[model samples]
Target chain A: MPTINVQMFEGRTLEQKRAFVKAITEAACTTLGSSPESVDVIITDVKKDNWATGGVLWTDKK
Target chain B: MPTINVQMFEGRTLEQKRAFVKAITEAACTTLGSSPESVDVIITDVKKDNWATGGVLWTDKK
Candidate 1:
């Protein structure tokens, strides 16, 4: 089983999540020769304060 | 960078999270010889309805 975890900024709608998982499953199957049932996509909605880049938190970024 | 992602049931306190990340970072450094600064730990709090195993959702399990 191939489990793909995505950590993104919070605020995506339910419809977006559904479409994202569907597209990701298809792409994984096409590229890796995996079955749709064997793929798992777990989405994590991260807050700006919880994420950082270049040693600076997203919340503090300009 | 070695980014460790942990998916677990929600409801942990902020103190618990701090302890967890510290411990995990130390473990990675000890086991993988990676620097503590280079280790990133991302924790995802999962809800029962969103996670499933063996074709069964956790919320629906008895």
Candidate 2:
């Protein structure tokens, strides 16, 4: 089983999550020869303040 | 950047998370030769129903 973990900014809708998992499972099946049932997509919703880029937190970035 | 993603059961305290990240960062530095600042630990708290093994969800397991 291939477990895909994603960390992204919060505020995505349930429908978006549904679409995302479906798309990712399809992509894995096409590229890695994995079955949809064998794919697991775990999504972590991260606050902007928690993520940093180039030493600056996303909340502080313009 | 070494981004370490962890999926575990939910209900962890904030202090636990702090200690866990610190320990993981130190481990990465020791084993992977990665700098503490360059190591990112992202934890995804999973519900029992959301996780499965051996074709059985944790919620259904004995």
* Highest TM-score scorer: 2
Instruction: Give the alpha carbon lDDT tens digit for every residue of A1-62 in model 1.
Output: 78877788988766566667778878888998988778876767889999999999999999
Q: Where in model 2 is the C-alpha error above 4 Å? A: B1-6, B9-44, B47-62
Local distance difference test scores for all models: 0.79, 0.78
True-structure lDDT of candidate 1 = 0.79
What's the true lDDT of residue B37 in model 1? 93
TM-score of chain A of 1: 0.93
Q: Which stretch of 10 consecutive residues in model 2 chain A shows the poorest summed lDDT?
A: A13-22
Q: What lDDT score goes with residue A19 in model 2? A: 62
Segments in model 1 whose C-alpha atoms lie over 4 Å from true places: B1-44, B48-62
lDDT winner among the candidates? 1
Ten-residue stretch with the least lDDT total in model 1 chain B: B49-58
TM-score of each: 0.55, 0.56
Return the top candidate by DockQ.
1
